[model samples]
Target: MAANESADGSLRAPEDFRSSTCGDTKSLKKSHLACRGAVAIAAISLITAIILSSILFAIWGAAREEDPTFQNKQTENLQQCQKQCEDLKMMLHLATQDSRCRLCPEGWLWWRRHCYFFSVGLQENRRWKESAEFCQEHNSSLVEIKDDAEMDFLQGVMCNATKFPFLWVGLTDSQQEGRWLWLSGKDIQDHLPLVVQWDSDDRDCADLRGDGTLFAADCEEYGPWACKRES
Candidate 1:
């Protein structure tokens, strides 16, 4: 009976050792599961952080694009540059025009793209036809009053150059009665301001009075004259 009892006690001791081994295995498994869970949480946190960062960056870029002050500043800079370029071009054009105007003849005067010569101190006065011939000899023609601007220039130049009473121009009604014509074949009534004083008869040539008006006169009348040509 004592031997049998000892064997039973040894068998019970083996069962207790198996139970302890099982408990250790269970604890190791639980620790492994907890470690796996922590790793998964870290991975999820990293992914979420990356997503949030990307979202913030996109919002910042959008805000910058919508900034009105920044856009307006860029536009203002562009407009200022354009205006400066236009001013430079205008300056160049004016310089070129001035240079061209300086190429007029020494004894002539430059006005509005034409060179004018007023017969100021001629030894002898010329008749209307003789004045026309004289101007033609000089590679020009008798002055033809065109627009108000040219008339103004002629008056100003004549007043400054000479004290002559009347100057013969290229206006005449000799071609047809009562129909005035310029030397260029253009009708005077069509091209120029009709500030002419007509006579009843025996008047075919035109003369510019000191008052800046035209007067019909005889072709044989002698007076100082003006000539005009391209500059």
Candidate 2:
């Protein structure tokens, strides 16, 4: 009749059995609570670790950016890039100003990497030495014809400038009696002797006629002259 009694009618203590069952339930509850507590602690530790790692990373990044050496290096790189850009712009401007591949300046003729300027009036004309000095003042020298193409160009430009028989140029045999040399101290060896149409008599200076012919003449002759320099 007791709640703890079995079918065989053996004597049983209901309070002691109830107490034992309650003890087992308490053990189960404690195990469940311990498991939940351990899981919560693990979750909290992981979150703390993540937050600490993020803080450390942020600190390191900020410190690195604020470092004097790093900042100086970045500034130096930026300045170097700006300097290179400025150099490029200057080079472009100079190239536009020079370089016979492009147009020549006002009142100057461009031909094969050289710029030619002809004196306009009789007052502007000078003797061979004076003309050489004039060209040197402009940072150039009296014109030197290296080949037939150059000769033709010189003659064409001179023809447009004047109809004179002999236009003074850079060639002269003053240094040696027979050997002609340019004002730049270069020998006139490239042009053949037959190509040089000097007068039968010997003279110190040379000139380019309107017909693209070269003739030996007096060095003191006053006339218009051409100046030449690289692009």
Tens digits of per-residue lDDT, candidate 2, 1-231, equal 002223564432244322322224345445545555555554555555556556555555576657868655555555654555555555545544432223333445668866676654322445678778766765567888777788778767666654444567788888777777877687877663424455434478787778776777776656667778553
For residue 59, model 1's alpha carbon misses the true position, in angstroms, by: 44
Candidate 1: where are CA atoms >4 Å away?
1-102
Poorest 10 consecutive residues by lDDT, candidate 2: 16-25
Model 2: lDDT to the true structure: 0.60
Candidate closest to the true structure, highest lDDT? 1
User: Which structure among the candidates has the greatest TM-score?
Assistant: 1
Candidate 1: C-alpha RMSD to true structure equals 49.5
- Provide TM-scores for the models: 0.54, 0.50
Q: What is the C-alpha lDDT of each candidate?
A: 0.66, 0.60
